[model samples]
Target: MVYRDYNISIVVTIFISLGLSIININTINSILIFGQNNVLSDVVCEKPGIKSISASGALKSHPPKNVIDGNQNTRWSVSGIDSWVQVDFGEKRNICEIDISWYKGDQRSYSFVVEVSNDGKNFKEIQSTRSSGTTNDFENYELKDSEIRYLKIIVTKNTENNWASINDIAFNMNKEPDQNLSDPKTEPESPFIPTKGYGDNIAVAADWSCGTPAKKTVKNVIAMEPSLLVVPGDMSYDNTGDCWLDIISPINDLVRITLGNHDVDEGNPESLAKQYIDHFKLPNTYYSFDYKNIHFLMLNSETDFDVGSKQYNFVLNDLKQIEIDPNIEWIITVFHHPIYTTATKHSPNEKFRDIYHPIFDQYDVDFVIQGHVHNYQRTYPIVFNGHNPDTPIVTDQHKNTYVDPTGQIYLITGTAGRQNHELIGQANYNADQYKGFGFLNLMLSNDGKTIKGVFYSNNNGEIIDEFVVQKTGAIKPINPDRNYQDDKNDQDNLQSNPLDSLFSDILNSTPRYK
Candidate 1:
């Protein structure tokens, strides 16, 4: 009996040991799995040396290299539907995530499938989704643990035209940690000054595209060596956002932009607005600045402009302050929708005129530059009673010059590259009209009283239009009233000015061009 009891005890001991051993093994396995996941999270999969990239077709100007160049300003563009870009890793890799920064990402949704392949030729679909169309930020897609050496992004559909563009691409490898994964990539910020002085000539143009006159127009603009380039609106026709930037890279740093219908017409208007604001580093949708003796006001016709709206209040307040500043000799307003146009495709934006024309006359604005007409039309120094353009209450118009103009000179210079629309003949208020591709090169005199504008055509270097604006005497400052004082006080009370924040690095810094 004692012998039997001993055997039973030995068997129980063996069972207990097995149980302990099983529990310890599971605990170790759990710890290892957790550690591996953490390590995978830190691994960056985008190692260009180990991968080869190819696209179905890319614009000659925009190549596949641009996708991996780490520059959002550059991009790879593919024409037509079912366009695809593939990245082939030399060897199989454990990929956990993929990130893509798309071109014109702010405006349109894109539908695509992510496929992976072990062999270079045969691919199996792994993931697919419709993008949210946020341009300024990357859209990240997480994948299940899979060994993939070759990856392909097949774009099946898009909300915009039949063009697909990608600014940058990235991946997260699952096996090991990568230092680049820890390094945060960010868009480079350009310098901007809220109120500064500039003396060189300013080049103004709009409606640039990839077509005939656009490239030629940009070439001419580069040769001009102007201190500033202001494109009022309709900067790009192709939804590939980087196309326009690439075309204008030579003068990009010198360029400033305003929103146009074409700019905000795609995808989500709000998303496009955010992207525009971020890409340009604008303080807001509307802001003012001083370049040399000129006070420039950039407005957003796409946004709300009715009285009491944020934009309206900003404009009214901005003009009031500029009216009191003695250094300001000229007030030039720029926006997408023209207050006056002779093109039959689009009529004068009477809504805009009724809202802002009175304020312009009240402040004695010098010039108003606009786009969206696809042609050039300059209105005489005229005032309006909401419906009709009438001669200014207190102004004069001569051959090519205006003396003491009572109203703003409306210049519609939209002929940059897009095809010109047929004009419905000249209007009674139109001082000049032209249907061609060209830009305005305005030279402000040293004395800050004369503005000589020359419109150079892209087709054959012909001078399409030329005019001059001369100020006879000092600009009368708007009378300082209690309301004006209160506005100034409110502006001063703000701890951080939006302009200062948007251009913190460059606001007080020395002018880049000056």
Candidate 2:
């Protein structure tokens, strides 16, 4: 889509401006090389020159050929789960990008996987992603360069309906430059800096969608300038999600969200949730990441999470390994539902309290952040009781502060642009509660021993609630009553790279820092 016009006169003028003498062919080559850093400076690549386009099926007037006809009005519309659109380059060619304009893209998103092949019989999947659903124009999706003669898009499902339609599509490719620089003058580029961050402050809030509350919530979040923004759940209430996506565009790079009931899979292969995942480039619905000395475990409450289930096993094994690690100083779990809450809208789940509260106590988890009640509530560092789930063993009842806490303290900051819920009576377990639109600012101290939780109401910038959690001494497990298997640890075999294990995803794109 880009065209560059460079003439010998312009090159000579640039060379003359640089005060060059004895200009020859080699000197001219050097000047050309110096003019740009890209090796394919003179290479022209408009499209892959699609020889033919075919699809599994099409409606009456719409056909696959319309996709490559360079017309936005024409499109290929098909309806099926595994329906596909294939394109041929006539010969093997190196491709690195795909530009496509989906029909009615402004209304809904489409999910699909792209596969490429040198031979027509064997294909390799290159990327699994979705469209922005906000643009009818061409959106370029980059990929690794591979030589292929055949390419196809396998449509899974679109968000709005079962139809898969594309207005225009193009595969851009580049051939190896034939020109060689006899006298090169290109300097080495500087080391790349990461587009994301890992710093002290972590901003948290949830249940945000649209309207004035959502806009004000965004302002509050950006005001803190947090290195990381963790939204527990209930992110985009709208199925199209254009509203939330537009509002959060300012801090999309630093956001990490968990799955909520509203964000669950719809069996349209999880129509809305999958779109969110692909848009954010997340590894999965639930995952773990380490920031500085803190280990953040994001869980999916909408899916199965029983003791022997996949998510349960994941967290159990994950925490067992982190138990002995010397690097991790704090453990924070994030999810949608709450195990302990006095809010009457959504009653606390006794099963989660019985199953995970003991695990969090065992693994020395510090905080459990959740969103679902549409209000804010904080509890004292408490341990679970299977026989008596109503009254948890409140370890530290200082009300406002805990020093070297005995158990994991749970906090529900669900007041992130949603209807507020009222608590039952004066609950003894609740530390501080608020019913308003606000955000939770977890300010990590310089020594990394204390994390002060501050809830600021977005309406009047009032400090509705505040609490302090400090690890002033060694972690002492409460030895709470439990009925679960305890794995063995030799302490001698506790050898692993927590840094590499936690940060393997970002290593290729960023330098490690917090």
Q: Pick the candidate with the highest lDDT.
A: 2
lDDT of 2 by residue, 124-231 (tens): 987555666786666544433356788888767665556767766645455542112112332113321213422366889987755456566776677667888899
True-structure RMSD for candidate 1: 24.0
Clashing residue pairs in candidate 2 (N, C-alpha, C atoms within 3 angstroms): none
- The digit string of per-residue lDDT tens for model 1 on 1-514 reads 0000111100000001111111110000000000012111211223434468898888887777677666777777867666777777688766644566666667776666678898878887765555566554665444433566787777766665667777766543434432112222211132111123233568898876554356667767776667789989766543335567777888877888887865664333345455656776666666777787888888888778889977787778788888788988899999988877664556667777888988897888888999988788876666555333432222333334544455677898887865455687777667788877777877776377767676766544566666666677845444322222133245443243333332232222212211
Which residue ranges in model 1 land beyond 4 Å of their true spot?
Answer: 1-199, 267-271, 386-394, 474-514
lDDT of 2 at 315: 84
User: What lDDT would candidate 2 get against the real structure?
Assistant: 0.64
TM of each candidate vs. truth: 0.54, 0.55
